[model samples]
Target: MKVANKNIVVTGGGNGVGRELTLKLLSKGAKVIAIDVNQFALQETFRISGKNPNLLIRVLDITDKESVFNFAEEIVSSLGHIDGVINNAGIIQPFIDLKDLKFEQIDRIMNVNFFGTLYMTKAFLNHLLTRPEAHIVNVASMGGFFPFPGQNSYGASKAAVKLMTEGLYSELLGTNVHVSIVFPGGIATDIMKNSDITDKAASDSEKNSKLLLSPAAAASKIISGMEKNKYRLFVGKDSKIMNFMYGINAGFATRLIKRVMGSKMSMEA
Candidate 1:
């Protein structure tokens, strides 16, 4: 499932790893359609892409199923085919306890992180099935695998994404679609700013650390995995290590994450 010369769609392409994915896919000779909720941010991504002819930027809210279907129809009609889709758009819940989180806040996180990915995948799945070979890449998180005290809702939503992607991979077996689930650990990106979270405590902690992977490196690994049609892709060293740890002992992994992130998270509460 080489992305070169394929028609690929990337959601949340305005910033962070999504923006990097757009740039990397374009560089690999793919015709990329970058989707984002922010028009200004999409424009910024376009500007950073050197305005490549192969790149198309679209302002889209992936949570709207009707709109996603219509947009997928338009892409297939205009581009002549749909080869791949990267469900990368997502938002984080506030860094507070689950008891302190309102129902509406939980809804917002689930809608964007899980339902949004579901809608996009459903809308384009039929179109993808028509292709000789197609690909689906869904980005989950380390939090999806290991529990984070303050980011419970966010982690749950991503966990849903992880399971959904895995189910898709299983169901699509013997089909032309190559489904991949990505579990990304700490990465050097403005995800907090994008998610509208103001966690000064967590910000201070991050500033003192140099363990996060860069967006470019993460994107490179993702694209390479997609090209190889990999089933599971781990973006950072932290993701790979924690994956093994969690697999060995879930209780220990949960306690370790709590010990590491709980203090900073308590400041938000």
Candidate 2:
């Protein structure tokens, strides 16, 4: 579905790719409602957008199902209707193996990454079905399909999102509501800080990496995918390459990632 002149909602719009998505949507003449848990970050995004009238920023925590449903109701009541929703809000676990990781960390990761997307999707789906053309975009991760050492739980949560989105696509096949699942590789963003993970090894590795995609470029790809109603989108060159590698041999791909990322994770633990 075309986004121009349509009302689209993007979660986690305060920072990172979500912020970039909000800005780009505005540029495309879409009425954007950008929601994030961080009020200050939402303000920053608003300021960065020059406080565009077409952009609306709201502070929301997607993990809260009741609040999510209420917010969806409010948006439709106030704005008349919504054309799309991009579930982009998520957080990663600490750089620790599953055995050593605390249960709290796993719960938080699942709540925000998987359940949060579920709530948001369920909340807006009915409204989306009412529109002539509507879209639902869920942002999973490359880890969702490939194994990453010290991020097993995080990968699992995203993997759930991946399947859930795919299922939604199948269920809505003949409907006006289009579903798209996105698998994004490494992107230049403050995810470590945002996730409240302070691992020096992980931080150093990400900081020195030159291969990560920029948030703006990632957002552009996501929007383009949405416009075309793609069922699945791989956001970065690394994600695309890894997807192909995994398709060839899942065992080899898993071993390769463990060999590369395990060393860095060992340094942290």
Candidate 3:
């Protein structure tokens, strides 16, 4: 379904690609309900977008199932219907090996990245059904498809999202809702900082990598994928290349990813 004139909900709408998505959607004449845990970032997005009537910002913790359910009802009551949803909210794990990571850290990553997406999808699934046509865009990562050296827990969470989205697509094949899973490679965003990793050298190395796509470009590709109802969308050149390379030889891909990233980090697993 086209985004124009649609009532869409964007999770993680506070910053980065989410913020860009909100602005882009409004520019296309869509009414957007932007949800984020950070009120300040949401305000920043509002400021950047000029706070049009088409944009509504809400502070939400998507990991809280009850809160998500309540927000879904609120959207339905206020907007009459929801035309689409973009589950763009997710967080990465600290650059540490799986064995060295604490259980609390793993749980938090799973809660926000996996359960958060599930909650939003369940909360809004019925509402989306009532629309003439609806779309569900779940942002997974290349890490989900091809493992990253230090982001094991994060990758697992996103992999869960990727499979769940694909299952939804299969189940809703003849239904009104269409599902799209996005695999984004390195994107120019503050995810490391957001993840609270203080490894300045690691951050600098990542920033210096040639593979990172800009947030605005990633948003455009994502929006275009939603409009086109693509089953699996690869956002960056890195995503596309890695996906193909991984498909050809999973073992080789794994070794290459580890070789490129493992040396840069201090980890135990």
Question: Evaluated with lDDT, which candidate comes out highest?
Answer: 2
TM-score of each: 0.95, 0.95, 0.94
Worst 10 residues of 2 by lDDT: 199-208
Clashes of 1: 0
Q: Which ranges in model 3 have alpha carbons more than 4 Å from their true place?
A: 199-209, 266-269
lDDT of 2 by residue, 53-171 (tens): 99999999998999999999999999999999999999998877788999999999999999999999999998899999999999999999988878999999999999999999999
Model 1, 1-269: lDDT tens per residue?
99899999999999988999999999999999999999999999999999899999999998788998999999899989989999989888777889999999998899999999999999999889989999999999988988877899999999999999999999999999999999998887777778878533246456335798878888999999999999999888899999999999999998988887877656745
Count clashing residue pairs in model 2.
0
What CA RMSD would you report for each candidate?
2.2, 2.0, 2.5
lDDT of 2 at 50: 96
Evaluate residue 149 in candidate 3 and report its C-alpha lDDT on the 0 to 100 scale: 83
lDDT of each: 0.91, 0.93, 0.90
Pairs with steric clashes in candidate 2: none
The most accurate candidate by TM-score is: 2
Better of 1 and 2 by TM-score: 2
Query: What residue pairs clash in candidate 3, if any at all?
Result: none
Order the candidate numbers by lDDT, best to worst: 2, 1, 3
Cα TM-score of candidate 3 = 0.94
